[model samples]
Target chain A: MIERRIQSGVGPKTGHKNEKGVGCLNIIVCIKQVPSTSNVEVDPVTGVLRRDGIKSKMNPYDLFALEQAFLLREQYGGTVAALSMGPNQAMDVLYEALYMGADSAVLASDRRFAGADVLATSYTLAQCVRKMGKYDLIVCGKQTTDGDTGQVGPEMAEWLEIPHACNAISIESFSEGAFTVKVNMDHSIYTLKIEAPCLITVDKDVNTPRLPSYLRRKRAGNAQISVWSMDDLADQAESHYGLSGSPTQVERIFPPEAHDDRECFKGSGEELADRLYSLLRQKKRI
Target chain B: MAHIEVNQKKVTPEIAERLSSVCPFGALVVGEKGLSIESGCRLCGLCLKADKDGVLTLVKDEPTVEVVKSSSRGIAVLAECMGNQVHPITLELLGKALEMAAPTGQPVFVVVIGWKVSSAVESLRCYGADKIYVYDDRSLEHFEPLRYASCVEDFVRKVRPSVVMAGATSMGRSVAPRIAARFRTGITADCTGLALREDGDLVQTRPAFGGNIMAQIVTPRTRPQLCTVRYRVFDAAQKREGPTSQVEVMEEPDGLEKAGACILEVLAKPKEPDISEAEVIVAVGRGVKDEAGLHLVRKLADILGAQLACTRPMVENGWFDPRRQIGLSGRTVKPKLIITIGVSGAVQFAAGMDKSEFIISINNDPEASIFNISHLGLVGDLYEVLPAFIEKVGREEPVR
Candidate 1:
């Protein structure tokens, strides 16, 4: 067992994250495929995307980040490489990006890449980004819908030795290589400028994503998609990907077990309203 | 399926417990039970992979934080759009902001179209907006962010508001960070509630680190506090008689710069479950067991005519659609009737599905927090409880 602790000052410094985006900006965005829902109804028998006619889609927030990238392209005219770590099907988002106007896309798909945790994910993505060449800017959603782990983007930036903002709301500019932007942290607004190749994870409100033009959508669907497996990304210790590489493992799954005396108050408006108010007050959810 | 973070070092159980306290899941026990696997884990598996010595295992764990927040100034809601075809959240924000504002001196002001815009600014008066700042313009049609930010900046400068409220809509969200940055203010995303502090500070509360933890943050320094409320978290402001009009309008952004940020195309969402508006939801996680069990719940849903939703597992296993899953990775639901079967109320999973009108939880764990929020807590296996429910309902009951 390794005994360690985060230094008191090890947390992100209180300053602008985009302070250095003043130079020629090179950016790479790492994305992932996540279960859009935590309530993913699984088959006790076979774990699979139930096509029993049920449906699913990409995480909505990721699309907004992609949209922000497209807008950035319109502004700075830089290369936007969409990097995602997932199964072969994860290409759906990559292709979606291409259709929306990404310069290129890379798929980190491999058996070994399966079940990688945030640390492993960031490690693998940093390596993949290194392989994808250089960039001044990197973007992603604050957190994937399923994984809900907002650590990857910041973790990736830390591993890559670049500054990062975990909750970026607006990107003011990306000039010279220094990127200037704003973030919502704790309760303060931070206007920061950082050197390029920095990482940013934005919320869905960052931008209204443009619908994929039918033409580009078709082109991306037909483009020669590049798939990079664990072997393809890096020849690291086999303990680096999936369950073997991951430190945390999901031991078991169970539904929430609770027995609140959730007795409903059925009555007239005043009574119900009183009941509702008391309930909210009791739960402290008001 | 766990994604554990390796801080390049291991943390002591004490610190782990502290981090866990601030974490969405419950505190780490350090060794033994907390090590191998947790007791209240939602099966997110993110923290699990953060280590390698098998220090942390993904089990059903408790959410470190609470969903609601507290502050001195009460809830600071930034109401963006609230006229014509107003989103229910707009009024809900108004009602909540009014409630939160009443206890404190924080006035709930509604931000409308910037100067010279055509949105119905007058209609907002009925919803509890103490003052209105309408920044209007043609570019504001689709909520041009640049213009929105510029307008908010102007309003914040003039008002010096204790808390600047905004909806978590695409427009409000984009505008929030930029505005907050302009003032160097701290902004919380998709917050479910807001409150004030004894020191007259705003506590911006929302689900943090995913749905596992609900956190309350305060801007101890920045002025004109900011908070972005998640949609549908509160009830709409009931309309009042006479007039809900006669409000104020704000100055528009600089013309040329505002017109420059163009929106090439904006498409409305076209889908089902519209999880955003569902009044009745039956969210199922691992408690429903496997895909076959999901079918049973679906049958029950069909019998009750309720939308069937799942947790992350069903999607990971391809047993359900990602859209239908509830939690941090999924949609937030505040249904009228939310029946849980076998689902452990992990904080992340609980964050998105906790706001139901009537919550009925069916899990074997007698101490699960789901009972804390359930309208009716059933301490038994869902398999046993569900059949009885189906019989009672007879068939799926539509909203006839």
Candidate 2:
């Protein structure tokens, strides 16, 4: 129930030539709450992951990304806004971000958002960012620890109409209005430039995240967090948002059953090797 | 460019010039190539063809040429094979490299950097490497992307094997791209398949466009045809006859002296129940509904001794943790039994566990495409089948 306000109507834009050092660069980092990897347990009866009493944590990668955002804010004046979209409980990860030095946090939580896939998720997130208004740079982890597809960043970029740099190697230089980054492509490194209001994904190498500071942790530990539901966003369209908006859906789920159960590859190493050689030869691979 | 009429219409540019006093459309009334539409032809679909190419597509009642980007070059494959564990994909790459190299008759050499001089030398033979280059030093135990990159770059400078195959494990993912940066080469990641084209170029293929599209990528300009493939993409080559291994160890520490090992040492942690090894996998994704649903799925998996897993999205939502998530971002699993319920099969996840022995799928939608790769697909609710499966297996077990 704490009152949240955007400090200033418009902030100084970092990494842009026009605004050098006059005001703070309002920054937002998107984070997700995920199941705790450290204490993952499988249910014995149904072979499903046990999540009833399992703990949740800030995504493993988002911490590094938020740390990078905080460092950028420290070097240049800025406010780090950690935002997320999930159920009501997603506030926990948001709090973790706030504890790490985020100036503000937003949780777009609602029942309508359930079963939303990446494309819809990105659209919902883009709407939230638009709600956040003007900012300098947007930092996100290269990919969520769980969804490893890495489509959300590009999808968000497409929605925001901004350039997205994936797997950034280094930000050679960033000023109030200008930025230079050596981005890691599949194989090649591309040195790219985008004047303020750009999006970049941070990898483990961007910057090591710090443990929560005493002052910030103390304040955030008791901070009254704000949660917004789907109806909260004004002019929220239902045609293409959340699960209803997702074009792709999970068709089925099943366990793999072996076609040929010829498990025996009997013999010693040399003999087995010869027999394998024959099998591979029969397969026309050798 | 001039276009002539097809079928029946006939009017030459010379005839059009003579008849210019009558024609209203600006372009030449007729030419040799095909029909020339003038200003009046506002892309209206007056003319169309149903040929296989179907170059012309009717969009909004107008003929718009269907411009498509051909499924061109396969992605680059950065094969990583430089360590003590002797990465499985290293042989997968050799099989791939040999296949790719056969057309070009290019030699294959590997790069190795570990603590032991003798062991690193011997490991290459079992790996089927033509010539193994070694940079032995106690300093090179852990994988420091920056330093390890320089060492690999040093090897690239000498051996320069086309399609440098390295194991795309955690170490390879870190160092391969950095070294690729040094060579200004392209690196395709976790390629499940690789081939050399008739033109003697290495063709790398990996999942792209959100696991729905399988993209084939290739590097046209780079020298050491770089690639990085995941461990289980291809089956490891079977051990060959006695010592078919031709191995060579490189001695020049040269520029590597500056690339001092910032790494102290790498300690292999005790292995856990790797998601990749689960004989029976019951993976749940975002579709699992709620916390109660997650518990239900777990109850079913427990009865089967099956490992519980989730999609990346499910993990992001705190439905499951990283250790229990299966996909490109987590561990790649190829269990003997894989049962997916309410999970859409994405390429990233499929690549990791596509080699599973038998795949059974359960989803409400009959068109749910996981059935395409599944052995037995049931079109129904997971809630119904999961509990029944657990009961069937339970009843089958002896009273002991």
Candidate 3:
């Protein structure tokens, strides 16, 4: 188990400061591995998602988030670390992150952290961040395709007692300890500035993710990727890490009832509209 | 927080082995000391159920006792708004709350947090709220996530309502979870349906695991059962003239202006016609080739006096305004007539428009999933079918 310490002094290795006099930034991009296809099945008895034969890939939204982190790292001299919480196989996404541009990777994997809901998942991620070391900023995808809650990043920010913004369209400006961003809030986009040690969940389709370099893949094949279990985290309580920590209870999950009743009308456009208008009239909708 | 206790003296190696299999979350570990409860323990009592000998007991964690203060009555609705006017979804939530309130013999309360919302009180009362709590402050003119969350959290802590409902809008999504986190309570987000059980539990039904299934979630032990209902999921509350709801002005929290982030500016997005309220809507999907195809869609909509909408991809491609997009994440429209052109109905898109009174889907792909929900399915090229439909409709009904 790796012990986490919050270093107070600046290290000689990254003593370079920006023009605004801020120390070298340490950015952590949180990613998750999700089933590639949407055809996942759930066990009715256990109420757990099944992933036996399904292939996994880095969450599609996280790609934009990593792209944003890479851009920030390029503009400012900083070290970017890829962090994730999942099973051992999640290292595949971490390895991909290494080939892309992340300086390092860490996976918080343990059997004890399984079946976590949004709250427990965010708490586990918050503990993982605390263990990974000091970070100036944390980046995450707007939401995971599998979970689709869009709540983890903000919840993690809450757990860490930091500020966070969701659906960020672009980083408008950045100084030493703060950055201004444009956030898309459905109807309106608001420009907001958040201080360092904050989190931002990037909107998908806003950035073009870079391709993994084959040269880097070959050279960094043996890159040291830290793997941490529950023992490694700051919060070692088993109850706070998994299903027990979750407050919501799922009584049942069943396939949505499908209605197969439909009518096929093969005719010219005029006949179709005539039929449609008559049908609406019959239903008294018009 | 949860409390799990095991009678170590009664636990045998076999019992420890059996305990590991009981927690689907793997919260129980079969250590050398027999069995130990982990942080992941939900206090579900499933382990006790599996162990017939009653060697285990699960209880609420005592350390966080203040979080469970006192159970209060009434159903509270978080009134969301666009400037001074209340959003329709808030009324929809109030409508559902009133329905649940009817059987429970509980009053309905509306909580409005904004500046200069006195004009909204009459509407809230008309919508069946027995009381209206308004938190009026200048700092709240624009949404700051944490500040808004803290204010609502303080209000909830003070009132201790049995249930709290919010619209699943962007602001609602941001605020509801924070309040839930503050209270350490369970929140069912984007719920499509809600019900009050005989035991006064709120059963929140929502699509889970990527819309593959609808899961019925319940906050059985938690007070102020929090839920965010999707817009248009429930009918709006009817307005009736009667005794006005009691109005109480709430003071803003002490640190309301000291949140971590600052809103640099609040620029209003371009005003577009709301398709959600349109009587007839003509929507196109990814199958449309380019701007020319979109022109045809526009012409058809013009002839039919319908609003133009599209599937999510069109919005992602910058072809349509997000306001004109129809899907689970976008606006839910239940128009009288909806014509989907070249749209293969994905489940996400179907969830938004399934309730349309009549749907006519025209696509070259006969096996398009949109056909399943469409009342009139035309299997042909939209390029061919759209122009023909426009010309026919124009000829049949000349402009007055």
Candidate 4:
């Protein structure tokens, strides 16, 4: 309980003089560097993702989340810090975030944190959040292309003890202490007004993400990304750090089977329908 | 045989009251007789976190316990139901679970948790469930993610099954992850294929990177392997006379009323037949430029007596109901015949309709990806091709 209340209004701001100086919000955008190609290899012996020597990119979904953060920062006058957890190479995504106008960036990496699942990953990220000072909001992609769980944001919110909404389609409005967000909840869309210090997992296509500005890239070329290890986190529990902290174990990984059984028929509209009807009738599926 | 016990000598009323607050399920009760452990206890160990003086202990039935591999005795299927009828995907999952259990000496169990689901019990037995665990309670009258997950987690821990399968529907998508998070287990979502490895492990396959590739995943070390198979990926389990089934009703977990995110109100969509059930479906995409284009698409659907569906663009354009949209964010359909008009098949849209028995796609651009999965591809302007098809069908003028 070492004063986790986030310090307000303290970061490299876009020195605009016309901004309101009362209380600026701090937003943390959670991002990850995933295999640029979906053809990722799994370690046969260890049942883990093999990350060595593969081209990586910022998760496609995270671009939406980052873009949303930048839009909010431009509108409400806040600092956006991009955070990620992976190998030391994960800093590449953080640097991309910086070029895309993140005020600052940080990467939490450790050998002990390897092979972590959704729960362990969320817990580790929560620990990093605690150590990285306070923020008014945390945003993440709806799900990772690699893990695709869509549980980390809410789970991390549970660990941090905050409210969160998933599948967010839009940020309708924001005021002093709360935000009105529209979320697609499967069957229907819901408009929820969540208080500050909340988390949201943004859906895809919320907005067009701006390209990394060459001017910002040149100016921020010397910007440093702070790296945090397990020791830096408030919770230094060994069991809660890496593979041991993970409840689910990867027993095995393999490629999926595919069926190439197909018959192509060329015909006119009526002929195709008649042929389809006869085929279905033969199979007794009509 | 792991069970929670309260030490009578060390327990006090104050401690008992605190213990009652600790278990979210309200398993530990403080009564005139000091304290009692109820059947509703889920063994979540939240009480252990609260009891500082060690008044309660979880006693294992045996010592020197070797590492516990995944359960090898039973396969479990989570029954997803709505409007008192079990979703067909539940039966499909049960069918696959039964197949997975066939080679191994394991029984299939179905857990149906809802009110007034007695009729579903017979259907579960017909679908090959040896035992149907029913938790029919007032608290479960409506679906709440936390409450439903707590109930399932309690049952899962009690009878550690080898594999747990659920339909990759809205409810499944929401609750499965919560259960996995609670048990600290791995779960694969939207799996298109599932198979058993040589050593009784499950190999779950799903599309990744926007359907660029299909990846196979496994839980490997987790007990009660969990996965959510997309709808229509497998055929529905055929009904058969199985062994005389037993319906065991478990006590409802208490404190479910306090679960977060109460459904204030569920605004129903406009009444329309679920497109997945349609035998023939004709869908339109962005290629259908205007209302005139939509009219022809409707005309063709009417000629075939088929249901009308669309890709995300149609719904986004306000030309079709969201319910009629087919894609990853929309409903999944596996119709006998599905024809796409002017629809360039994005992976998201293809995921919902790829399992159709036959696919015929019409796109003016020959390079459109929709041709990749189609059984019949027509490269022509829809405006020109639609009228010819309508005339050849010899259908009466469609009444608007």
DockQ for every prediction shown: 0.07, 0.03, 0.30, 0.07
lDDT by residue for model 2 (B1-400), tens: 1122333234444434333322211222355553343432212121332112232332321112221212122222233434445656666666666556555655566566765655545754664545666666655544434445556666666555555666656556545644443443445566666777665456666654232445455655445555667665666656766555565555645444333222222234445556765677888865578767777678657755688988878866666666787777767777777767787676566667777776766666665546666665556655555555544444545311
Cα RMSD of all models vs. native, in order, equals 14.5, 17.7, 7.2, 16.7
Report the lDDT tens digits of candidate 3 across residue range B182-214: 655678877877898766678888776553456
lDDT top scorer: 3
DockQ of 4: 0.07
**Candidate 3 segments whose C-alpha is farther than 4 A from its true place:** A1-23, A40-53, A258-274, A280-286, B1-72, B286-299, B313-323, B362-372, B375-395
> What is the lDDT for B265 in model 1?
40
Q: Which stretches of candidate 1 lie over 4 Å from their true place?
A: A1-25, A30-137, A142-260, A263-286, B1-77, B114-119, B209-213, B244-246, B255-260, B391-400
Quantify all predictions' global Cα lDDT against the true fold: 0.57, 0.56, 0.76, 0.71
Clashing pairs in 3: A238-B38, A238-B39, A238-B40, A239-B38, A239-B39, A239-B40, A240-B39, A244-B40, A244-B41, A244-B42
* TM per prediction: 0.55, 0.53, 0.81, 0.67
lDDT of 2 at A127: 75
Span of ten consecutive residues with least summed lDDT in model 1 chain B: B60-69
TM-score of the A chain in model 4: 0.81
Model 2 alpha-carbon miss at residue B239, Å = 1.7
Higher-TM-score candidate among 2 and 4? Answer: 4
Candidate 4 residue pairs in backbone clash = A6-A134, A251-B219, A251-B220
TM-score of chain A, all candidates: 0.78, 0.79, 0.83, 0.81
lDDT of 3 at B346: 67
Clashes of 2: 70
Tell me the fnat of candidate 4.
Answer: 0.13
Q: Where in model 2 is the C-alpha error above 4 Å?
A: A1-67, A71-140, A143-286, B1-83, B99-105, B255-257, B264-271, B290-292
